[model samples]
Target: MSSQPTSNAPVLHVQGLGFGFPGHSLFQDWSADFPAGLSLIQGGDGTGKTSLLRLFAGETAPQAGSVTLLGMDAVRQPAEYRAQVFWRDPRAPWPDTLTPLTWVEQLPAHHPRWSGEAWRAHVAGFGLAMHLHKPMYQLSSGSQRKVLLAAALASGAVLTLLDEPLAALDKPSISYLLQALEAEARASRWPGRAVLVAHYDALGDLPWCARIAL
Candidate 1:
């Protein structure tokens, strides 16, 4: 993993965050500061790990408090904030008719750091190159997840939030992701980049910069 010295400055800062649905509450007065590198968000079902990630990604606004990334208020400057983040809900609805290649081709416009070459490499690493031409509906769950994973890794966003990333992935793909993330953590250009992944199960034997449980 990354042997580079980590800075104390928080790449992502959350203050008195709160969120809830009709009758269920997720977080209340929750606060934390995430430094650069990989951070695992561990929790059981209903613990709101996913909710917290969504909040950080600007996909869902907090009911109270605020989220700051690189000194920018997520709520006040959502477009700018989101531009620096890469998040894709695994269960998010997709255009069933679109191929993976088509979907990935549009990512560069949204992610300035996007690398088409990196995307292709990740696709090959995940054994997804062969499936890129197939429609989303025709691909298996594992393949679909790989497509998204490839995009996330290639986007090179300052902050990347991935929920249930290991789910539906094969052993080889999982290993590839782990190794890729480790390399990302070590990169000099991505010094302030932070990757947050939510996992329900133990991240046993996996290299992580840190872990936080909800």
Candidate 2:
């Protein structure tokens, strides 16, 4: 992993964040500042990693507290804040008929920074060139997961939210992904930040990584 220095200003800030289901609390009174660069959030299974990501992505509201992306309150300015973030969940449902290229193009038109070539490159790096033409549902789980990851990285958004990124990949693919992620951060962007939620130990070796144990 390259040893690049990151800035002190937070690209993502969670203050007083709390979330839970009907009876139990997942995380309560939580706070964190994701400084510009890569941050790995590690926790055991059923420890609310996905729930926390959902709250951070604005997919669901937290019971209390707030998230700020690039200093813009995520709850107050969701549309604006979302423009700077890309959240990827491998299990997220998508129509079976959606092709990889079509899905990438479907990203909101408001994000003019999305790069088609970058996406193609990422897919190609994963040996997914042939699979792109196939419907998403026809591909194996690993292929579908790769597409999700490629789309998130290609978004060109400032803050990237990845849940279980290394679940179904071999060493070569994981290395390629790490390289791609690093290149994305070094490239020109509004506020580069990557919040990778994973149980995989290999992610800790990524360049400019900061560990957040929850």
Candidate 3:
């Protein structure tokens, strides 16, 4: 579970990348490489942090340049590339009405690495008390965020692309998540990388954080 991206190439490589919406450019000529630790994407509101993360996640096509993970081209090998990364966004949709436990149970059993008990413990760690049978939509926004966080942990992706990961979370939940992430980083001999976009500076004490402010 090392945080390395599985190749000599950077975990994330961006070269001459640019994106625009209507009359404004969100980002342009942005070239950077994310190495084997947590890289924080920091910016004020409307600075395109989410857009850039979406571009990296292969959810949105960048207007120019290239986004590559390991050695695979992002746009060319989208499915393979995306499978290695997990994206968590608040605006993203959830299962229509699945309960937390049922949703986790429905995942294909082929992924032996992600166990139900482990996810259950994770959810509990975040102070979410709902049983798996409870409807997800019935939970508060913060509680829903907890569910999504646990789901991301269970997904077992090498690269973690988190958008506002700390939003709507309490202090204990935040501490719990940071510990979980630290353990995730330690589990791998050379785990993939994690890129977190957040306004909070709580990441200051994280083991290794490279900051890039826009």
Best by lDDT: 1
The Cα local distance difference test for each model comes to: 0.85, 0.75, 0.72
Model 2 scores a TM of: 0.87
The candidate maximizing TM-score is 1
Query: By descending lDDT, how would the candidates be arranged?
Result: 1, 2, 3
Q: Model 3 misses residue 159 by how many Å?
A: 1.4
| Ranking, TM-score, top scorer first | 1, 2, 3
Each candidate's clash count: 0, 0, 11
User: Over all chains combined, what TM-score does candidate 3 have?
Assistant: 0.85
TM-score of each: 0.92, 0.87, 0.85
Root-mean-square deviation of Cα positions for candidate 3 versus the true structure, in angstroms = 3.1
> Candidate 3's residue-wise lDDT over 1-214, tens digit each?
2234454557788999989899998888999887766677777789888888888888898889998877667798887777667675776667777887777675535233455665777978987665556787777788888887887776665566777878889899988988887776565533555545455354656655457787
Give one digit per residue, the lDDT tens place, for model 2 in 1-214: 1122256667677899888988888888999877766677888788888888878887888788999876777778888777776786788677978998788778847456677777778888988989987998898888888888888877766677888887788788888988876776565563555545455454645665567776
Instruction: Assess candidate 3 and give its lDDT.
Output: 0.72
Q: Return the lDDT, model 1, position 16.
A: 99
